[model samples]
Target chain A: MSDNQKKLIEMIVGMQSPEAIELTKVMLEEGADPNTILDICRKAMDSVGQKFEAGEYFVPELILAGDMLERISELVKPLLKEGGGGQKKTHGKVLIGTVAGDLHDIGKNIVTFMLDVNGFEVKDIGIDVPVATFIKEIQDFQPAVVGLSGFLTLAYDAMKETVEAIKTAGLRDNMKIMIGGGQVDQVICDYTGADGFGLNAMHAVKFCKEWFGVKE
Target chain B: MNTATQPTSNNELYAERVQRLNDAIALRQPDRVPIIMNSLFWHTRHAGLSFRDAMYDYDGLSAATRKALDELQPDAYVLPHPIMALGPTMDIMGYRQLKWPGHDGVSNDVPFQYLDKEYMKADEYADYIFDPTGFMLHKYLPRIATAFEPLAKLPNFPSLYYTRIIHSTRSFANPDLVNAFQTLQKAGEEMGRMLGKTVQFIDDMAALGYPLAESATALSPYDLFADYFRGSKGIMLDMFMRKDLLLEAMDKAAKLIPLQAIPAAKHSRSKGVFIPLHWPGDGLMSPDQFKTFYWPPLRKVVMTLIENGLTPIMFWEGGCTSRLEHIMDIPPGKCVYFFERTDIFKAKEVLGKLVCLRGNVPGTVMSAGNPDDIKAYCKKLIEVAGKGGGFIMDGGSGIPDESKDENVQAMFDATREYGGYA
Candidate 1:
């Protein structure tokens, strides 16, 4: 990363959305490598995630960072066709959601943002997602991993039912299933028949990497 | 279910249990460890009644509750707040946040789900802090319930004050506003009657020897703001972007709650005030955030209640691993802290001498683990948390509404088997 590129990374990490957006546009207009820009955005997001974990930042910052990246992606995608640098070829695709009857999406949203920055193609089926949608998305998206997110105890039965439905439909063989939520534990994982549980969003990145045997 | 123990005619058994529980709260060793449960609509489901039944049939539901409590005979049980049980009025109010059984899309067995959306807008923090009651009357109520929608049209306060003084009839001249006031009055009367009956039922239960664990309930100011008002996404952003305003709102809420709660909880059986603490756990915020946002105002509330001779049962929702040390700031034997996901044993170790530790074996174990597993789990909770007479046996969270009878029965059975202090 060049001096200007490093400056852009710091701006993104600082959550200076307008400054970062303007810098990316200027850097690109002056012909900075799109790969470096993409790389720096990823690193900046990582910094935001770390701050969130450390309690220096919070949900609003995470939401803002996600928005910044989305805006930056729109700007950088057109210029990176030759370098193929705008979209890091997804290491793996993952389908994720908070299961039926659960309205909490904070944890799931954070994981989705984390996965996006870490270069995984994530399909968030959104909160209160039913089993049918999970199956449809699994078949449609062909994700390597499936994440069931729930914050309530009732979602336990829903998760177990969804996992069982997938097994009955013969889709379980194709994807690795993971459950993430505040209440989920090893016992909950076994009860829901999911392969593992993610303690937090960053833990999710480590889980995906461990599953695919890849390095970020 | 064993519906056999009714506390002998002199009410000795009931007194023994109440004394036992109160003793534990006072940091004195009782005959044995007492179990205090939130119950959390589990009893409604346990008796084969739907959550809908609890809302509609007070007599039948109270009978069901009486029957269930007679069987398990917890040292004492936390009664459900009757305000949430008024099905028709709540539905008619078009309360956007709560999904009740039968009337809402929710199934019969499921309890009411509190859906947190943005009721208080991000821009309204100043209004909320400056005049909360005024804001709640003219600004907040309209946004929260459809029944109060007409009030939203009332000009902002001071303007409305002047209008009320100048053209008193103008307030009622708007036919829609008149209709709204009538709806509000009628609904208030009906709700008051229903809530009155519920309070009567609780008194009757107390007369029958089963005292309530928490007669008064207060939502922590932080949660009141984060949950019902700004929501996690909104308030959290405010925390980063507008820290002072958020804290101001929280402090105002903390001071205002006692006005609604303390006077109303004057029932003879009302002992401890219940404050459910959410969003302070390690999962939601870090230690520093918790110290800054949650502890100070809530602690002040607890101390005030204590000075006024009320025990405060502070239930820690989610987990409290990050903020356990801060929990120790309270005076010894001054309060009871019910933990959901916090390590109860570690809590006992940390704040055992300071506050009584109640709870929390994971609620899932009842349905997911075997009866023996629950017994073992309860035994472990008793062994670790029951030391020095500061622990009560109960679910980490409330019992899941779907937990089986045998699993829940194990809670009492394990208490008898392994929880005896004598």
Candidate 2:
């Protein structure tokens, strides 16, 4: 890796947004490969994700890092398209939403952004989504994985109903379903009839990666 | 022993329940651990009223609450479920912060939802810090409630003085601003009626031998900004983007919150202030970040309440296991650390000696599991956390609104059966 690329990754990981944005512009001006720069940005995001998993960072850090990545991507996207690279390749398709009776979206939004950056084509159907909406989105998107999110105790009931609806609609076999947010345990997962449960956004990403047979 | 043989008068029972709770708060052993039925809509469910009915019909809400409390007599009650009876008042003012059961297309059975948004824009921090009241009247209120939208057309009221005051009074004559004040008047009347029912409920509960848990409510200054103004996304970015302004705004709130809370607490029946925490849990911010951005202003609010001789019952909503050590820096026996998702055992180990612990029977068990599961959980809670006193038996986030009556009964039964101290 070149010196500027290394500096770029370090700056992004450190949450130095202005410096990272400046260096990205300088690298592009210096005739660096746009794909190479995008690759370094992904590596930085990966490191940020690792720090979060290791408990060294938390939501604020993740949000700051996400904001920085967006700015850098805006800078690099045109160059990549000019080079005929045609945007980053989406590894797999994932459909996610907060289930009925749940209005929380902070956890779901974080998961959506993380999956998007990790090369997954994610469809976020928004909060308080009905079982019919989930079924309709699953048929249209034909996603490899479906994630049900809820932050209330009542959401568990809704989740169980949503998962059962997916089964009744014959969409269960084609996709793996995961449930997340607010006091979810093995008991809840079984109650919801989900294939697995995620404790955080990274866990959700890991579920998608594993299901799609994508190696890190 | 003779007390059990006689029919206890309501006066005697009131004093007994009050003593039990006070002893628990002061880190003293009561006869047994005390149970606080912190359920909001569950009482309505038990009374066969939907949450919509509970929110809209104050008389029905009061009757339902009385019925539930009469059946499951707790040591204390967190009366009138803060927002349950204010549906009409919110509707009058077009309150935009929360979407309730019947008014906003939300299902009648579900709890209210808070809409997190940048009600106060990022660039408006200096304005808020400069004059919070002015900004609140001119900017924040108008933005959040449609009834107050016309208030935005009025000039800054602080600048109006002497000749300016004489001229500024004319702004009030604007038809739109006049309509806004009428709207506020209508909302105030509705609120007065709701509060009348609330006061009546409190009086009835006291007469029937139950005490209200908290006298007044306050918010963490950081939470004030996060929930009502900057929002989760806005405040998270401000930590890095504008630390100084955020700190100043929180400092301002720190000074203002205690002013309202302390006086209200002093005039009320109980000496506790309910502060339901919305942020500053483990996943939202790291320990270091919490120590830096979240704790100082909150500690100020807490300490001020403590200095005023009021107990601050903070209901930590999410898992704040990492921040417990930081929170432990408070005066012993002066506060209650009520938790929702944090491990009760670990909290007891850490804060057992310092402050009273309330809560943490998971809502999942209350809503989904059977009576046996609840009894087992409450038995363990009472056995361990209730070991040397300073523990109050309650649900993780109060009793879940959809909790089964049988499961709730098991909680009360288990506490009485296994929670004896002597």
Best by lDDT: 2
DockQ top scorer: 2
Clashing pairs in 2: none
Local lDDT at B270 for model 2: 96
* Residue-level lDDT tens digits of model 1 in B1-422: 22334556537867887888888998988768888655756787777777788877777677777877789877787777464467867766777778777875677665677787888898899988877777887888988788888886665546556546677556667877888888888789878877777788887877777877777787788888889988877777676667899888888777788776677566547678888887777756656677888888788777767777788888898778768888777778878998988877787877888888888877778767779888888888878888768777788876776677888888889987877775
lDDT of each: 0.79, 0.88
Can you tell me the CAPRI class of model 2?
medium
lDDT of 1 by residue, A19-54 (tens): 888998999999987777888888888788778767
- Lowest summed lDDT across 10 adjacent residues in model 2 chain B is found at B1-10
TM for chain B in all models?
0.93, 0.97
Q: How many backbone clashes does candidate 1 have?
A: 2
i-RMS for every candidate (Å) is: 2.7, 1.4
Error at B12, model 2, angstroms: 0.9
TM-score for each of the candidates:
0.91, 0.96
Clashes of each: 2, 0
Model 1 chain B scores worst on lDDT over the 10 consecutive residues at B1-10
User: What C-alpha RMSD separates each model from the true structure?
Assistant: 3.4, 2.0
Candidate 2 whole-model C-alpha lDDT, 0 to 1: 0.88
